[model samples]
Target: MPRPGARDPQAPVATADVSTAAESMPRGQRSAARPIPALTLVSHPTAARIGERLLLQGLLAGREVALSRNAPDFTRPGEPLGLPLGDPFLSRKPVLFVPVGEGVRVVPGDEGRCTCAGEPLHGGREFGPEELARGVPLEFSGRTVLLLHLAPPPEAHAPASLGMVGQSAALHGLRRHIERVADVDVPVLIRGETGAGKELVAQALHARSRRGGPFISVNLGAIPKELAAAELFGSVRGAFTGAQRDREGFFRAAQGGTLFLDEVGEASPEVQVMLLRVLETGEMYPVGASRPVATDVRLVAATDADLEAQIADGRFRAPLLHRLAGYELRIPPLRERREDIGPLFLHFARQELEALGEAHLLTPSDPYAPPWVPAALAVRLLLYPWPGNIRQLRNVAKQLVIGSRGQSFLELDARLAQELRLPQTAPHRTPPPGAPTPAPAPEPEAAARRKSTEVGEEELLAALRAHDWDVKKAAHHLGIARSSIYDLIERSPSIRLAGDLSVEELTLCFHACGGNLDEMVRRLEVSKRALNRRVKELGLVPKDA
Candidate 1:
């Protein structure tokens, strides 16, 4: 009888070098290497000890592990190994976990109480490998959340976070990426969505390098195309109108240090050529300067755009891209690391609380008081697809601390409820003796629409019409989480992307709405920016044209 989440003895584990190298691989290829199942403790009421990981590295099909109040501890994995649960509310008898083919069979003990994929486990449930990769969230005893995910066992080689928070395995992988590339002077490409902290990655690289000069950052997209060349490679006095003294561009400003070019995909053709020349020849010719000046600077570039697509369309240079990507690192989006939300929210919330002189809010009002942050709320936070990544999460944390200033627990007003896709009204329950009150736990999973997979196309359209296309309200009405409905909308045949709309339809809607973007959005049922882009592409909008 093995304990729950047991490690497989023969699995290929990640040494520091392997972990760092894998960061550059395509996600599909990377998944092939991390084939073993693992559990990471992501959340707890007392979160100081969270982020413990257990790599069931070699646990094969038919092997079993158990979980209970005092399940046996297995701690062979390094750095962030999982610890004992020690939850008094858990049953004394072990809940069994058996690996089926590519999924896991979770059989609850007679008294076991846990929620899987927002479902209560009364008997047994199966979680497929895909769900595990996205992190199968398991809430236990109403006080803990464990993420069942893939593991490749990261070593504790990198110690510096450089202002990053959370101890998720993904974060550990990111740390390894930074360390492995830091000492080298090669051009590193950081690819991630906006607000995913590309600049932080850039800084970490610079800090570890031997370069002693200043680190300079510039957003090429923000600079006008006419000035991009001068902005990056500097200009001589009298080179152009109002060029007072010789302007030292970002390249010279950074000198021997790093020049971090953000939004590199947005660089103009002229600027791209200039970048390529300097990267290849170690020399740059400033605007109106006859002589090429010798330069030495490590370059790191970041972008959210599809550079490959840009190259295929002849919008970006292929050789410039290849030069920039001598090394590459992809930051995992926040949704992919949902396990970190609790700790990240708490980390940001406490900082805001401290700034407002309300640090006391971090502590319970009494031994029996409810948590300032409710567990149900935690579930919603974890499930949200954070398009804005860590920056948006931090903003929400500040909002939570400030919005619930006078309350005993964080309360959702209409704004927050709409934002979180939870109802404004929450159920309440009393606390036991010497225990903190838990908000009413989430209602047991409703059988009808428990999953997005269960909802049909007809049902999805009906919900959309019933709610006037208000996604939040419709998602609430359908009993699916916000991300699920958004996904469904993406998949629905009737919902047209702006690209799918014809010029004739857009022009008709444009005139019908009197060129009002908001009205066009309402009448066309398309996103404002996408619609605007399509309109501009067709020369329907004069200024854009």
Candidate 2:
């Protein structure tokens, strides 16, 4: 029988890597199973209705491959397989597949929407689990959608950096661009905010490239203006004052491989002129050297600065920017892709635990460290704007893991606020003038079962307010599980949440705080995490970030 919620056993879920799944199957069953398809064009009417009549499926085995519907052209060929779907409506190249883990993943090309078993697949989402289990011969969009599980492709392990760890469209687009240009010899420009992992993207490009030479990175901004040329283009013996021995620069060091020039925007005028000449002629002249050396390097340049503005100001050369930006990749900041925070934190935390030789501390049932588990941590993580991006988050996770002293809730809220540079203040409230106030606080554990059972929306709201709108605290007061409290929040949409500020008012305050999250938290008089959530709910993007 197929797995639970599965439609058929003939085509099991594609979530698991092909190797593991194939090895698990019985020898006889494995041989009987159909081969995985490089391109499966389903022609069901329901699929047609969903604008996905042509479903081009393929394997992601580390190497990049393309799935196309049109006939293959010698001038512009598709990788792995090229099957004609007989549907002219579909684009020639609808999607590209990049292997992740032991499984395959598909990235939609310019094609609008892709569906599996009638359910739409968002960007970076794989076609497996429910859709794969639905099997072949399923009817959709007024035609029969076909499933072909051809023999699995060879397994190739992907590097950890390739695991960009997000399902956001921005990340998917970045991966797609990298796959398209990785194998080719070209100049690429990577632009993003500082600490946004620009070097990681450069490394990913080099890792995926066919060229197997050493990867060298040069930080142009760090080099003194006078030494720029010598640092990048080398200097021969007796070329300058010290009469030092001949030294190979970044260009020669990265021969036959990839050369990443970080902060290329910092290139001096003389350096820019030389760089332009070398990029155009495929050679560079060493400082004080009579002859030009033949350079064989795939150049990938990155900058957090606005090169266009620099060009306009005559600080950066237009031609050089044009040359370096043969293909451009933009990496969105952490605040922009908050969905990735939880996974990234867990990944970093595990790495720290393993490094500290405390792997056993993470039980299979609770891999996340105590006090600051995934569920609670996710709320805090998603709330902050993550000004320092991934680098900042990694530091935070390391601190949390090392500091969790076997407490129930890991009493680090104050530490986190301080570390985040947020202002520290206790929550407070005062009764209205002349208002008759007061009743003794109820002993939560001693509260009668009847009173707990009689809890209603008003009681829940009061508890939440008493605890400063903490979900867990409110749940305990109501004698219910935290998950049940979450369910209540979801089911009762009309219930007034604790916060009284409107979206516009919160946005105005955020702007007034000059997009500083710490300042905004203090100004709003809320917990750092709570403020983060409200900002997200209002779809606020810190102007500075």
Candidate 3:
């Protein structure tokens, strides 16, 4: 978003909430624009396309709404939206979508294959208006995924491709803004949080513009103060210490194209004057050049900082701000568009998996097993307050793909949990005086034990190494059951059990590591528990405990 990337002339882009895009409509149009219950396809058994909506306004006339395997009344998206899901694994019985007073009740069929929020749906579950507003994910037969959310009625014109993904209304609004101003030949001031994908919006503007020049992007905050002027404008040879020849700076490089300046608020006072001159007169003076050079480049600047505060502090020039903000595009934070999380995740996962020739990971195994990306994880992704925005979500997608390599299913390790900032300890709150006594809480867990869910592959390996391959000690230290730890080892393709090692190999490694079980664990990569037992059975002299 430059706040969700769209044009709204009525309000300042900085303060506009993209979620309330429909609120701006006239009284008559507002009723037509009011969001109604809808289901958008996220994934299909055989197709990767998404974002086709199944509006319920026309389909549900205050009665029951049905989503069966053979439902043929609805419109199709990328896949046969009016499917049989084309998934042979799906049950013949249909899942009912009954509209209650304000919320919709999802009644799972007898097969019990549906899941949401990381739990299997065995019975009817009602999604409140609030939950549906944020969007609820429903998985069928471990293959098809549909997001149940509130969406406005269909528009006469579909959104043009601006390289943005998702079916959220905010995204639609953003497209509207970009389409309106892309070819107006005006400097665009993009305001958004860091990692909110401001540069993507800038690119979209350029892509949609009439200019045929290349897009040049640079981070104003990253450029050194001394080099800022020379970098933006050209420098003649012998003008500076590093200048051996005439330099074509960003302005000239992007001639007739768009130049995106990220973190524009960080521009120094000196550079500010230069920018002001360029905007005022369409001419710039290079650091060591004698004459002014005219540039036809479109200017797009982005910043997450409060420029008004900087203006009050006398750091940034107000005149420069006026020039850069010919048009404003505000990008909404990731938290505002939770419905897009699932589709965005799949988009990223597919890219990474396909690149590594592990595209098969995109599909679940046999019907009984879970999907590669767990529903709980998807819900967590939606719930997480991503301060880093879309950039953070992309990182998580890459982590899941690389971390789950060679495994049948992805595991939630400690590192990922910490990164997502998922709650670890239950913080005790002081009860008010004279309040009724609360029920006793469960026993406190071990002080420093590492549970299976809390330990990542590397962390688990390190714990084993620290405990010298003693499974019991490691299990105790990890606060996990020994059997569960063994299961973790069994699932790890990189780790080996003592049984897999030959007696000769064990004896040779025993001498190689000088019978140091810890060292042996590192070299053999076998379970310390099994290795220790083998050492005992071999009757080797017990050196250290």
Candidate 1: residue pairs that collide: 3-65, 3-66, 4-65, 4-66, 8-58, 53-81, 53-82
Comparing 1 and 2 on lDDT, the stronger one:
1
- Residue-wise C-alpha lDDT for candidate 2, range 127-227, written one tens digit per residue: 34222322222211222233322323222532123756643324544665677668656677887656778898888888888347899989998999998
Q: What TM-score quantifies how close candidate 1 is to the native fold?
A: 0.67
- TM-scores, all models, native as reference: 0.67, 0.48, 0.67
RMSD (CA, angstroms), candidate 2: 22.6
Best-fitting candidate, scored by lDDT:
3
Per-residue lDDT of model 1, residues 337-405, tens digit only: 665676678788778878988777664435344446565666777666665788988998888778888
Global lDDT scores for all candidate models: 0.69, 0.56, 0.71
Give the CA lDDT, 0 to 100, for residue 146 in model 3: 76
* 310-418: candidate 3 lDDT, tens digit per residue: 6756888987887788787777667667667767777887888888898875555554455565545655676566767789889988898888888765667889987
